[model samples]
Target: MATPLIEICVEGIDGFLAAQEAGADRVELCASLVEGGLTPSLATVRAAVKAARIPVHVIVRPRGGDFLYSEAEFATMLEDIRILRGEGVAGVVIGCLTPDGLIDEARTKALVQAARPMAVTCHRAFDMTADAGEALEALVRAGVDRVLTSGQRDTALEGLAILKRIADQAAGRITVMGCGALDADSIRTVRDAAGLRELHFAALRTVPSGMAFRNPHVGMGGTGKDREYELTLTDTEAVRATIAAAKS
Candidate 1:
C-alpha cells in the first residue's frame, strides 16, 4: 500500500510552514481553530501560497458553527474563492448544505465550477448530511475532488465503520479524506482501518503567554469569562512525531 499523504490543518503562517517542515504533504489553511476554522485573510492566504513548498488548500468557510450559509454569506464565500483562485492556491475546500442537512447541489456545483482547474474539496460539512452514502453521490455529482469527513462522528476512530463503507462506496469516483480529532495513533488507525489514502489533523500545542502582567478582570475567550492568555501553535516536533508514527 502507498503511504498516505499527511495534510495538516494550520491556522497561521507559522503552523503552515511548520507543517511543511515537519513532513506534511499538504496544508488546509484557515484561521481561528476555536471557531472550527474560518477563512483566513487574503494576506495570510497569499503568504501561505508563496511560502508553502507543498500544496496549499485554502478553506473557504466564511464562518463557523453550521454548514448552512445565507445568500450573502454564500456570496462572500464566492468572492473569497475568487481571490484565492487568482492567488494560485492549489485548491479550495468548501461545502454548502441546505437546511435539511442535504448537499446544496446547485450552490455547491456553482462554487466548484468557479474554482475550476483547482481542486475543490467538499469539507467536513459532508459529515452533517442526511445520509453519508447519499451525500457522497451528491458530492460526486457536484464535481468535488474530495470529501473530508470522520464518518459523521466526533473523531475518526468513532467513525471507522462508516468511513470504511464510504471509502468502499466511493469506488474511486472521489477521494474520501479522513479528518477530525485525530492524533498520531488515530491517524494511523483511521488510515489502516478505513483504508483511507489521505489524512488530515492539526498538531497544535498550548504555548504560555509571555506577558508578565496578567489581567484577570477581563476574559478573551472561554465560557467562564476568564481571560486566558495561552496561545496554541502547531508544534513542529509534534507534527514530525505524528508523521513518523503514522508511517511506523
Candidate 2:
C-alpha cells in the first residue's frame, strides 16, 4: 500500500513556497482566512503559481457570507476563474448553492464550463447543501473533478462515517478530498475510515502575535491577541507522520 497524497491549502505566497518545500503534492491558494477563505488576488495567485514547484489550485470565492451567489457575485467568480486559468493555475476550487441549500446546478455548471482546461473542485459548500448524496450526484453530473469536504461535519474526524459512505457512493466517479481539522495525528484515521487515498489540510500552526500591548478599553474585554497568519510552509513532521500512518 502507498501513502495517500497530501494537498496543502496555502493562505499566502509564503505558505505556498513552504508547502512545496515540505513535499506537498499540490497546493490550494486562497486569501482572507478570517472569513474562512476568499478568492485570492490575481497578483497573489500569480506569485504563488510562479514560486510553487507543485500545482497551485486557486479558490474562486467572491465573498465569504454564503455559498449562494447573486448574479453579480457569480459574474465576479467567473471572471476570476478566467483570469486564474490564464495565470496558469493547475485547478480552480469553487462551490455555489441555491437559497434552499441544494446544489445550484445551473450556476455550478457554468463555472465548470468556464474553467475548461483547468480542473474544477467543488469546495466545502457541499456540507451546506441539504443532501450530501444528492449533491454528490449533482457535482458528478456537472463534470467537477473533485470535492473538498469535511464529511458534512464540523471537522473531518466527526464526518468520517459519512465521508466513507460518500466515497463508496462516488465509486471513483468523483474524487473526495477530506479536509478541515486534519493534522498528522488524525490523518490516518480519516483516510482509513473514509476509505480514501487522498487528503487535504492547511497544516496551519499558529504564529505569535506581534502586538506587545493589550487594548483593554475596547468593548471586547480580553488579552489583545496578536493576529495569527497561516504560515505558507507545510508542517514536515505532520506530513511525514501522516504518510507513515497511511502506509501502516
Candidate 3:
C-alpha cells in the first residue's frame, strides 16, 4: 500500500514551518487551536504560504462551538475563501450544517464553488451530523473534495468501525481522512485498520512559557487553568515518527 498523507493541524507560522520541517505532507493552518481552529488572519496566511514547501490548507471556520452559521457568519466565510484563494493556498477546510444536523448543501455548495480550483474539505462538522452515510452523500452532492471525520465518535480509534464503513461507502466518490486523537503509536493501526489513505493529528506538546517575570495572580483564558505560561506546538520528532509509522 502507498504511504498515508499526514496533515498536521497547526496554529501559526511557527507550527506550519515545524510541520513542514518534520516532513508533514500538508498542514491545516488556523489561529486558535484551543478554539478548535478558527480562520487565520490574512497576514498569517501570507506568511505561511510564503514559507511553505508543503501544501497549506486554511480552515475557514469563523467561530467555534457549533457548525451552524448565521447569514452574517456565512458571508464572512465566503469572503475568507476569496482572500485565501488569492493567497494561493492548496485548499480550504469548511463546514456548515443545518439546525437538524444535515449538511447545509446550499451554503456548502456555494463555498465549494467559491473555492474553485483549490480543494474544499468538509471539516469534522461531518461527525456532528445525524448520520455518517447520509452526510457523505450530501458532501459529494455539494462537490466537496474530501472530508475530515472520526466516524461521529470522539476519536478515530474509537470510531474505527464507522470509519471503515465510511471509507467503503465513499467508494471513490469522496476522500475519507481519519482524524481525532491519532498519534505516532496508534497511527499505523488506525491507518491499516480503518483503510484510510490520509490521517490528521496535532502532535502538540505543551512547552512552558519563556517569560522571566511570573505573575501568579491572573490567568488569561478564564477557564481557571494556568496555561498562560505554556505554549502548544507541533513536535517535529513526533510528526516524523507518525509519518514513519504510517509508511512502515
Better of 1 and 2 by TM-score: 1
Which residue pairs of candidate 1 clash? 219-227
Candidate 3 on 116-141: residue-level lDDT in tens?
99999999999999998999999999
lDDT of 2: 0.82
2 or 3: which has the higher lDDT?
3
* Model 1 error, position 201 (Å): 0.6
Evaluate residue 240 in candidate 2 and report its C-alpha lDDT on the 0 to 100 scale.
55
TM-score of 1: 0.95
User: For residue 215, what is the lDDT in candidate 1?
Assistant: 68
Per-residue lDDT tens digits of candidate 1, residues 149-187? 999999998899999999999999999999878887678
- Give the top-scoring candidate (lDDT): 3
TM accuracy, model 3: 0.97
Give candidate 1 regions above 4 Å deviation. Answer: 220-228
Instruction: Estimate the overall C-alpha local distance difference test score of candidate 1.
Output: 0.89
Candidate 2, poorest ten consecutive residues by summed lDDT = 222-231
- Each candidate's TM vs. the true structure? 0.95, 0.89, 0.97
